[model samples]
Target: MTGHTAFGWRTFLLRWSGEWADSLPHDEARDPDDEAARRARWLGFPPASQERVTAMEERLGRRMPPSYRSFLLVTDGWRHAGGFVWLLAGTADARRHDNESELADMYEEDLDEDAGPEEWREAGIWRRGLQLDVRSDATYVLLDPEDVDEDGEWAVYTWASWRADAPKRYTDFGSFMEAMYREFHSLRAHRTGREPAFVNDTTRELDARVDEARRDALRGDWERALKTLDEAEEYGRPRARGLGDQIRRLLGRTHLVYFPDVVTDPRYAPELLPPLAAEHAAHSYRGDASLTFPLRGADDALVSQVFATLEQVRAGAYRYTAPGPFGEAVDRARELARWGDTDQAWRTLTDALPLWRPLGPDHLVPLGWVADPVLGPLLTVERGRELLSTPRGGHPGEAPAPTPGLDPPGLAWLVDPGPGGGRGPYRFVLVEGVEPEDLPARLGDEDAEGAALDAPRTLREARWHLPRGPRESSSYEDRPVMAVGRAGAGWSFAFDGDPAPFAPRRFVSPAASAAAGTRAVVVWSDLGARRGESFFHLSVARDGTREYAFTCTDGEIRRTGDIPRALDPDRFFAVPGAGAAAERPLLEAVAEHFGVRLPRHALLNGRLHTVTTRSWTRPPRDGETYLVWSMA
Candidate 1:
């Protein structure tokens, strides 16, 4: 009565029972009340009076466990799913069950194995037992009365009716009940396709915070809710991290934008550039920038046109010249249309229709091009009515050509091209499937002044610079530095600034670089901050393969498709003569790759500085060394 309130027990039972009922198919759940009653009838038997339970215990010559007694008082038996079994019996059923009789007979047959009380108890050979439940096939849940402890709690076991081995054991009825509850929940979730919210017993404090945050969210105090979730995350609660992401999305702080009609005509696609640029500005940096659209009748021209226009508009220049009367009219109409005089301009165009009427319908200019399948121009007489009567945002009818890869959002990067070269520090937009080209017109109609925009670089040309070591001195020292180059269709690396062949040591391999069509980066480093410099670079292929370029002391650059010694010292040092002083440069390079700072004293030591395979194979005994020098 004090530990678990009746309300809590009822709530749990009702919720789980309701979930079970909902999980049933429509045919089984036609009458909800009848279905619920049938399920409850199978799952819970009539509650047993305390006197009946006591009488059953007396007949069995053992006290029934308090937890089991309490469970019987609530519900005489359980018939829910329990691992490979069901139907746990009550006091009356347990006393007269056939399984109990069979268990007693088995105990009598194994009496010879029960030598003494202590040994029998230790071996779990009990004379008196209660058959709790029978599995679907050949298994039984049993409670051994002879194994009862000081608390009058009998040991529980799961017995395979056919197996000869000792049964799987549980400490008490409470533990058995816990296992049954977990199994029931798991089975319910699997069948229902709906997992109830998990309340962690160990994370009570964190759960309390989460509940408070939910309350805050309900009251529209999202900032406070987010703060609470952050605190929970700092405490290492993983659920808080997911909740935080959901809250950020709900607050519209995510960087992703939804513009499904972006890849339409090449002419009107430039309208997307401003909104995209604004989105980038809002996020500071574009993370996972994507442009999703329907794949049907998509044009590469739209992609190219958008990129070209963005470059030109950012640079304040128009490249394409209007050809013929129709082209000129389109150019003029667009200019006037953008300035909010679309109706008047359409009327003017209608007045001049006689001059361009001879150009034929195919050559007629398009006005206010919307996303549609038909690519011909609107008649001059219909232009005014369509412009003034069309609904807001225009209608997205169909595409002119089939554009693949647009259905799944295409990858794009808005990068700053750095300063100088007459180009302002505007972001250069590069879309993956779009060809680089010059724009026909400025991105927007706004007359901003600047130099002609440069063509945006392709994804392959977007080289990412690797991290460089800190500079300790201003002096120009002849130290080894790393460099990267393309080898065949893949990539290669070399150590520069060494002597003769050693300086330009290069390693090339087809397997070393990323697979064709995948994106990757070439990482190079000098591995020098103060002194004792070394050089190395590697290709981190798109498939996550790290190929190390090992430049030996003898000027031979060996390429190994394995992690270098510096990065994994234990594995590399496991081989004899592998960790020599001459390998220090490669080790230093690997160290630099992993951003490890070596001790200055260790670097200055001459004995430790130069290690070779010879030194490792033939070491000096005691403090003796043989050095043969010839006078030249």
Candidate 2:
């Protein structure tokens, strides 16, 4: 009957780490025996008070919500009534109760986690925990899910409450419902969705407002509910279930706000409220991390941005966080380290060294190894040379400037050990990683549009700038960006669009087709943008030989007569003097030798010329030769 006393409360108050449900008030604010008070005290019912126990159990059978069952089993918030108080234990309260709540609640509720319904039946321990409280007019015990009567469907559990103590049991919800209907004509079938439009109760308007807020919340109308819940809370007043928890759970699920700091505070626990002085402290830990900086400018800007983001991530400060992009960036960095450009990888390592401090050892050390696989051995040698200031015999200065022009440069081997005499097909294949600045100058025309991104690129960066080719849009929203068409022999050249004129710098070449057979000879002409809309000619030789020629000019092989005159008879069919003196022209040559008339205007006045020469035999041991020329 006093401010600090538990004079009429059923359960004693105790401090818990997290939040704890407050004890429900029983009779007597001193001895007040109302319906709500009866339900509140039902938990304290003793085994001898069967009538009170049975009534409370029946009332509970009528009022619990459905999702509570699933959430209870999964989270652990079990509880039971004993004497004048309820004893609870379960998963939902594990963190708060040191896992004790789980055992007490489960046992009192007759929930045998280890046994199924069939097992419980076979073991005959199915008599649920329905205890009676002899002192009260009514008391009840809640039945666990597994202990439910077989005929009960919608009614999943039972409880008891009584006007006075007696020994009686109800096997089904029907028995409880029949008793309730008989005693109180007000009893109605509580079909969940069939609640009437209005019930003439003093709290009807308040209930409507709360129901409306709940509906808004379930529909993800957070902003609307936020506005409405203020009014709903006022209406629900002192006895209402806290709307703050619902709001907190919703906001957390939507990730629209920080975790439920204020609502989850102990003040909302149906008891004393505290001032808003308390604030949660942040939890911080260190581990490896990766970062991607989206820099859109020149090379220097790119490098600086990349370095800065890496630095910040290393410093353990970031906003709007998610794990996926960071993980992907780390993976990409690892892959980049695997490339042959050990020096570049080293530079990357040096740039990102600051971030490595926060990362765990596994990520940091492996990153270094990835960046410089040879560094371990080099370290051993370098360790031996304590005074690195002394001059070494073979000191190579700065590396030579890259070769300029049309051809992509071959990969350089600065300290290769001649493969250490290893012999395999490894000699034929090559891997080249070109610096962005050197790439366009090496492959595309000087005046070509949209060639600004010549540096190294992230996949995101590449998607933003690359042509994406004719078959697909540049947006790259489609599922799989990389695809291999059906294999075939002929080569197919694809362009992002009808390519512009060669422009003295840009030119096209046929790509190797999907097939591995004889390649198609592609000749791209109509070279000017006007009529030269990116068309190509397929030149197939009868002898299974082919040649691809891309040009912007017409040629001199105009008439059949000009074909013979154009043929270089000395090299056409006759072998040179040093080798076999005479030999028939190769079939491709025969076509050229016999006077094949070229298309009209098929000449480009000195537009193209053969840039390479091939010999079928050793020079002095001469063999028949074929001519390649460019004409206007």
Candidate 3:
């Protein structure tokens, strides 16, 4: 037998034995004479002679494939598992293992008399195959001698005597063995609750060394653990590379240095501590699958040192460019603060301005860092100042003043407006008591109730206060409100309740509207009614300069030329008969007056009647005396 054949047989023995040993139940005693053990012993016997292989071939009247023949030279017979114990027939058992005769007999006994010629050929599986394994269970490993290729290798198959169907086939014996071995290993691993590591005789010593290293690591003797792993590497350099690295990292935990409180301390000088600390910190953060050591587990003094280093680096005291350890330190400090040492966390952050500055205008600190009441107030104040100083575009002190003549009404009209801009959809609130006769005049009067004259107010002037509720609802209540105007043909209606009315909302050009001749504005009570819950008010100045304004209960208020296509009133109202015919006169009047198409449905749904008149002292009741208007 050749060296290659001997090696292959030996590898098979080691793998089979390893799987069996690993798979045995802990509570069950293993038998030394078990089938797996018996086969392993047989494989160690002298290689089969050429004459013996030839004699077995003659008895079967068919030659074994080259790969199988080579395997036979190493070990003539073997047994293993995959659902069933597979038995490879040897030269000594050739006469009894002659499966060709048995196959022919099975074909004759099971052939269907009514089957078509092609069907019969397919069903006569026994005629084309030879059973290699002897089993009472009726499932057999088969070899298809009739399907031999140019290489003289027969196809292998697995056949079940109980099922009268063609056997499942494989390309050759080598592939068949390989597939069986993989499945066997997987099955054994599952049963044993441990992964099966294949170790042949050649690498047995190296594997033993690895096992010793693992034991050492578990006991925390990292020095000895790594040394043992190095010995394994000497025997298997390339293959042991990953194992070597893993051991080193595991051993590295012993040397982990905590963040020192003082940078100037002799123990924490740049050359002595940073490099070693960085390496150990990285490993600690990564964590071992078996042993985990968190950074917060370090003493408070050490943690203080870590932050001190970070602060020094931030202040350009030490040019520590590596961000990994620094980031880890921040995360560790935050974690510690979350677990109750918030003051230390705050101090760490206050000194690490360089790290926080790069985090953007918000200088977003971790939520835990600011959750502490004592630390929260101080941090927020400082953070807010830092954010305000961040250069956005204009100088920090040069914020543009509010647009003139655009203030909202009383405190009720004021909203929180949130951080970015004014909140909520642009909406209109009809100012009652003003009539059509007040056209173009009352809108310009600074003293007129709800007029544009009283519109421009500062945030302080609004004096808006918040009410408590579910967070989202309460937050919305704080949005700042602003007044809006409609440029009508001869008059305009003041919409004082809109939240956002500037560019991106109403496109305010304070200078543009002022330069244009005074536009006629009507506080049309009935016109607001003819329009819907939310209506479009067209304000036309005496100079014929017209401006279009559409109010929505929610969403941004879009101006004349910049309205999105989806919001186009024509799309919703262009269809005929969409609104009551009685309102057509008022719709036509507003559309014709403004020189634009009118949204009739919008007029019909206007919330004008919902307004409470400024002159009325009490809420209106059914049949009570109240000011009423007629569009006619």
* Candidate 1 lDDT over residue span 457-535, tens digit each: 1112212221144322211112222111111112221211122111221222221222333323233323221123333
Q: TM-score of every model?
A: 0.30, 0.22, 0.29
Q: Could you give candidate 2's per-residue lDDT for residues 1-632 as a string of tens digits?
A: 01111221212211110011122222224333333434443322222233433343365443222322222222233222222223332221211112121333434356458667665442222243322212322333233334454333222222334333322344432333233222221221111243332233324555566556544433434346556655444333211234433343222221222212222332321110110110010111222121111112225543343344334333322111113343343444333332222223233433332232212111101111211112211122222111121111122222222212111112111111233331101000000222312222222323323323222222222234434333321111111111011111111111111222332222222222211233222222221223433222222221222222222122211111112333333343233231111112222342243222111100110000010001111222145343433322
1 or 2, which is superior by lDDT?
1
Model 1 ranges with Cα > 4 A deviation: 1-15, 29-42, 81-83, 95-122, 125-127, 135-137, 146-150, 159-169, 192-612, 615-632
**Model 3 TM-score, 2 decimals:** 0.29
lDDT (Cα, tens digit) per residue for candidate 3, span 55-105: 888877777777678877877766563546445556665332244537646
What is candidate 1's local distance difference test score? 0.39
How much is 262 displaced in model 1, in angstroms? Answer: 32
Residue 360, model 1, lDDT:
19
**What are the lDDT figures for the candidates, one per model?**
0.39, 0.26, 0.40
* Pairs clashing within candidate 1: 297-401, 297-402, 298-401, 298-402, 298-403, 320-440, 581-611, 582-611
Ranking of models by lDDT: 3, 1, 2
